[model samples]
Target: MTTTRICVDPVTRIEGHLRIDCDIRDGQVVDAWSSGQMWRGIETILTGRDPRDAWLYTQRICGVCTTVHAIASVRAVEDALALEIPLNAQLIRNLIVAAHGIHDHLVHFYHLSALDWVDVVSALKADPMATERLAQGLSDWPNNNARYFAEVQSRVGKFVASGQLGIFAHGYWGHAAMRLPPEANLMAVAHYLEAMDYQRKSNQITAILGGKTPHIQNLAVGGVANAINPDEQSALNMERLAYLKTLMDELQGFVRRVYLPDVIVIAALYADWLPYGAGVMNYLSVPDFPRDTKGTDFGMPGGYIPAADLTQFHAVKHFGDPYFEQNVKESIKHSWYKGDWTRSPYDGETVPEYTDFQQDAAYSWVKSPSFADEPAQVGPLANVLAGVASGHAGTIGYLNTALERIGAITGSPVPMAALHSSLGRHLARCVRTQVLYDMMVENYQALVANIAAGDTTSFNPPTFPKGEQMGYGFHEAPRGVLSHWVVIENGKIKNYQAVVPSTWNAGPRNQNDARGPYEASLIGNPILEEERPLEVLRTVHSFDPCLACAIHLHDNARQTIVRVNAF
Candidate 1:
């Protein structure tokens, strides 16, 4: 058998720099490697900084998930102090998280990964009226009209006729793998534009409560800085709350009617993908959206599943659970770091020793993160599986709805087990979005009700003691389980580390040579074309790879570049 090496450098349509190398044999990927081309050293920058200011700095780690890092950092400090935030603070943070997730997931599916399945060139050939009818059949979204689709089709036609593909430049436009019909492609193209408006509305929810998007300003050590006064005009007043509710309403409508239907339709069209991209079956996710101030009860459940065996599942009862904390370690065996030993994240070190890519040696900047001595995948799919396995009502309801819809479209009963593939990751995101839409509304109502009952407190001041103290914060973010570990000594951050979602999924092999989720998923994937590795991109994008968050950026002093594009 002749083996060929296919290298995809700077994988497009993702956050940071990544290069995927796969060895193809007999037209299928026999082996693969996921490399983070840049090294992220944000953790090293946090040494000797004020613990309270860590969130502001750490959030800069990724422009895409700024709010998530901010929330996680503050929560870690609060955990170290053993502080309990006020209920209003809890509600406010929950709303920000839910809203950010809505925006992130929406942009991820439509803007980042949709083109992998949607054919823009084909869409130009679709009849505008037929596309409108297709959209109407999928959902009752009011944008389902002949005029709206015609406008979208015309825009697409102009883009193609201009001979400038722009973002669509490197796409496998006419690949044999492209399966969707021209009419379906047109419908997706229309929703893709409308998604931009919906995502903006979702971001407004974050901005209203957090004072800004990307990086929020309201988070403090103990709680949020958002003032809660029902009548006060300058603070978080009733008027602002009403406006927030309106934004939430619009966002929810888009997710339910537009986003959910699109995912189901796409999944149905590519039902053959159900068996591929089933990477490391082991899953991990932490509970999010605390219902109380102490973070005791959660709106979402978290747990671990080793080897895809749901029967041997273990629930993560609370923050800093022994099973999670003690078992979490980062191995530098295949990373461009000094050490080869796997140590707990609290004691983790990031000493860079860069050497050009070596297939058998260090290849990535991301340290392999393992839970319970095993590589586990963390993301929406993990969260959904954990919730469904643990019988969490919200997760169960959402999963059922997604399975039923996908099944109805494919003319077959989509079992729960089918949710272990590339399509499953996409479906899980839509399911998680549905659960978050309701959670956003529920948390918002709780905030209003609490304020009406003469309780307007939002922040609780946190105090740090002398000597060394260490703690961790966990959140089931839009991508999956995101945790920040902190070591505070005498009111300063002694050390800091963030085990981000991308790190878990895109990291390299461990000490035992066990492949990471991205590498493992590509093992048996059919490479339809060597030059156009659309199948590889589909699997990688399914993880929504954000190497910027997983590994820090590379700053080059001599290079000056400017990008300008017309959409």
Candidate 2:
């Protein structure tokens, strides 16, 4: 058997720099490597800074998922001080998280990864009437009209005729692996354009509550910086609450009538992808959306599910869960770091020691994070599985609906085991989005009711003690389980480390030399064309790799930071 090496440097349509290398044998990937091509040193920058101001700095780690870091940072500091957040503050934070997550998931599916599955060039051959009929049969979305699809087709045709495809320029158009019919392609392309407007509406919910979207200004050490005054003009008044409800209504409508159904249709069309990309199946997620001050109660349940078995789920119940903290360790053995020790994030170190891509040695800047002495996958799949295992009604309900819809489309009952594949990840994300929308509405109503009861508190002051304190905060972020570990010595940050979601998925090899999630997921993935490995991207993009969260650094000197070695 002849083996060929394929390298995709700086994988497009993602957040940061990532390089993927695969060895193809007999038209299938036999071995793979995932490398984070940059170094993120936010932890080092947080050292010696005021612990109260950590959220402001940590939130700047990634431009896309800024709100997640901010929420996690505040929770970590509050946990360290043993502070209890006000109910209003908790509800407000929950709203921000839920909105941001919905927005992020929408953008990821329609804008980022959808192109890997939908072919734009083929849409030009579609008949407007056929496309409209296809979309209408799937969902009763108002835009499923022949004239509207024809208008979209004309706009896309103009892009093609102008000799500039803009965003659609570099796609693997007309590839043999592209299997959607021309009518289905046209429908998907139309939705791709309309998704931009709906996603913005979802993001507006975050901006309204958090003061801004990219880096929210509402987070503080003990509680949110938002003031609660029902009648006052400048504070959280009824008018603003009503506006939030309106945004939630529009977002929920689009998600249910368009986003969820679109994903199910695409999953049914690409059902062949359902058996691939089930890598590093030990799943880990953390409970979020706290209902009380101490963080013991949650709106969504989370835990560890080993080997995709929901029966073995172990729940992470609170803010500072020992099961989560003690078992989490990052190994730098195959990373471009100083040491080869597998230490907890509480004692983690980040010293750069670059060695150009050695296949069996140091390769990526992403440190392998192991949950309970083994590599575990994180993200919506993990979150949904854990929720189902814990008997969360909302998660189970949405998940079953999605499975049933796919089954109706494909003419076969989609089994639970199918969720361990690439299509499963996509379906799980949509299910999670539906659950999040319900949570958002519930939190909004709770906020309104609490305000009507004459309780208008939204902040709590904090005071650090005279001795050392250690605390860790975990949130089931948009990507997966995001944790911030802090070591405060007399009100100053002594050591800070963030075990981000991307680090858990895109990591190279673990301390035991086992391949990480991204690498392991590509093991049996079929590579139809060695030159244009579109199949390779479908599996990787399913994970929604965000290298900026795993590793990121900018050079002020503008010199070449590192050299790429082609295989």
Candidate 3:
């Protein structure tokens, strides 16, 4: 069989530059390489910085994933000092986390990855009334009317006529792999435009709580900087809380009525894609939304499920669980780093050595991260599966509801095992979003009740000891499990390493020379057209790749760089 090597240089619509190389044999990807075409030296930048101020710098690692990194940084410092923050702080932080997650998932589906499955040009051929009928049958969202869809269609038509698709440009329109009908395409496009508004509303909650969106201003070592006083307008008072509830209500409605339903409909329509993209099934996620100050109890459950087997689940109990710390290691063998050894994050080093795109050797800048000496996939799918394995009621309830809806659409029962595929990742993300909505409401109420009880404290000052201490903090971020490891020496950061979600999923071969999740998932994925690999984008986009978190840009010359392309 003749194999064709295809190179998708700098996969667009993602956070950072990522080059995906695949070998196509008989229209199927037989082998693949996932490479992060950048380097992130944030770990080395914090060499001798103050531990308390570490969160501020770390949050800048990625503009999109700022809040998660901020939260993880502070938690790491707190864990190292064994500090417990106030309950009010915990609740406030939870709200920020949930809101950020909701906003991220919304934008990812509608704005980023939706174009892979939805054909914008085909929507131009759709009947507005037919699209309205299809949308109304799925959900009672108020905008599901012919007039509204017609207006949306007109707006899109203008963009097309102007020859400036803008965000909709560069799409593989009319591709053979695009399976949706014209009406369905129009409906998805309509929802895609509406999603922009709701995602902003979700971010408002984060801005209100965290003082900003990209790089939140409220996080501290011990707790959040948000003061509480119902009578004071400047503090986190009743009026702000009420406003937040209103935003939450709007977001929850969209998630239930629009976002969740949209994903389910798309998944059902693309049911044939359900069997592909389930690779490196060793799942790993960490417990988040802490209910207590010591970081022991959580509203959401997270653990490890090895080899796609739910029965072999192992929960990482607390803040500094030896189970997690002892097993986490990063191998630089296939990465563009100085070392060739697999070392724990505590002893991790990030010295760059650029050896451009060596397929048989070092290729990616992302270090291969492993758990228990194996590549474990991390993301919403991992979070949902871990929750289901741990018997969490909220996760189970939402999972069953989504499965039933998909099954109803397909005229058959969707088994739990089916969730181990591409469409399953999309479904699992929706399930996680629904559960997160409930968590947001619960945390909001808890914050109100606590404040009503006259407990308004949100911060607890930290006192670092005069010695070296190492600690790790893990958060089940929007992408997956994001952890920050810190070695603090006399109040200064000795060493810092962030094993981000993308690092786990988008990495190169591990120490055992095993393909990472992204590379492995691409195997067996069909490439309908050699020149235009729309099928390739469908599976890769399912993971919501954020290479910015996995790698970073380092250009010391400060020169303008441009690459012209002829498509």
Score each candidate by Cα lDDT: 0.90, 0.92, 0.91
TM-score of each: 0.97, 0.98, 0.98
On the 0 to 100 scale, the lDDT of residue 345 in model 3 is 95
TM-score of 3: 0.98
Off by over 4 Å in 1: 554-567
Count of residue pairs whose backbone atoms collide, per candidate: 1, 1, 1
Which candidate leads in lDDT?
2
Q: Across residues 355-385, which tens digit of lDDT does each residue of candidate 3 receive?
A: 8889889999999999999998999999999
Model 2 C-alpha lDDT per residue in residues 83-127, reported as the tens digit of each score: 999999999999999999999999999999999999998999999
Query: Which residue pairs clash within candidate 2?
Result: 40-552
Candidate 1 per-residue lDDT over residues 1-567, each given as its tens digit:
899999999998999999999999999999999999888888988989999999999889999999999988988888888889899999999999999999999999999999999988898888888888888988999988888888888887888899987656767888999989999999998888889999999999999899988789999988888887777898999999999988887787899999999999999889988899998999999988899988878888899988888777798877667777888888999999997889888999988988889879999998999998889999999999888888878878877887787788889999887889998999999999999988898899999999999998888888889999999998998988899999999999998999999999999998789999999999999888998999999999999988899999534453444456889
lDDT of 1 at 414: 91
Clash count for candidate 3 is 1
**Residue pairs in steric clash, candidate 1?**
40-552
Candidate 2: global Cα-lDDT?
A: 0.92
- Cα RMSD (angstroms) for every candidate in the order listed: 2.2, 2.6, 2.1
Summing lDDT over every window of 10 consecutive residues in candidate 2, give the lowest-scoring window.
553-562
